[model samples]
Target: MAKITYVNADGDSTIIDVANGDSVMRGAVLNGVKGIVAQCGGGASCGTCHVYVDPENTKPLADMHRVEDELLYFTACERKENSRLSCQLPVSEELDGLVVHLPEKQL
Candidate 1:
């Protein structure tokens, strides 16, 4: 299992142990973490699961897809260089202790 830390807009943090191969969005939704709407479930169609990967931990994540890259522009939050759709990030031993900061909203 990989331990992932989700930090909400207000700075509150929730840590969850995710099974290997689970997406970060699924892990957060399963753990009831607030701020992540995950409206499209695990699909890349919606950008509701947007998150900012800690700069120090971004290396382990897979490269962004063109669809995710395009959808991110529609997110309610400001998109940064580290912004990513959590559904695109798979949990793995390499991602243990990964930290993702949530945006102020997920509309």
Candidate 2:
């Protein structure tokens, strides 16, 4: 299992042990972490699962796809260079210890 750290909007952090192949959003929601609504479930259609990948670990994620890029534009929270839809990020051994900073709001 990979340990993922989620930093909430209030600067509180929650660490979860995620099984490989699980989406980051799934892990966060399963653990009942606040700040991640994931309103569209794991589908990329909604920007509710938006999260910012820590800059130091941003290079490993797959490049953003067109649909994800478009939905990101509509996110209620500000988007950053490392903004990503949590559902789009699959957990892996390489992603162990991955840290994501949640936006202030999801809607």
Candidate 1 residue spans exceeding 4 A from truth: none
Question: Per-residue lDDT for 1-107 in model 1, tens only?
Answer: 89999999889999999999999999999999999899999889989999999888744788899999999999999999999999999988999999999999999
Displacement of residue 13 (Cα, Å) in model 2 is 0.4
Per-residue lDDT of 14 in model 2: 93
Which 10-residue window of candidate 1 scores lowest in summed lDDT? 54-63
The models' CA-based lDDT, in order, is 0.93, 0.91
Each model's backbone clash number: 0, 0
Best by TM-score: 1
Residue-by-residue lDDT tens digits, candidate 2, 1-107: 78999999889999999998998999999999998999989889989999999888843676688999999999999878889999999988888889999999998
Number of clashing pairs, model 1?
0
Model 2 spans with C-alpha error above 4 angstroms = none
- In order, what is each prediction's RMSD in angstroms? 0.9, 1.1
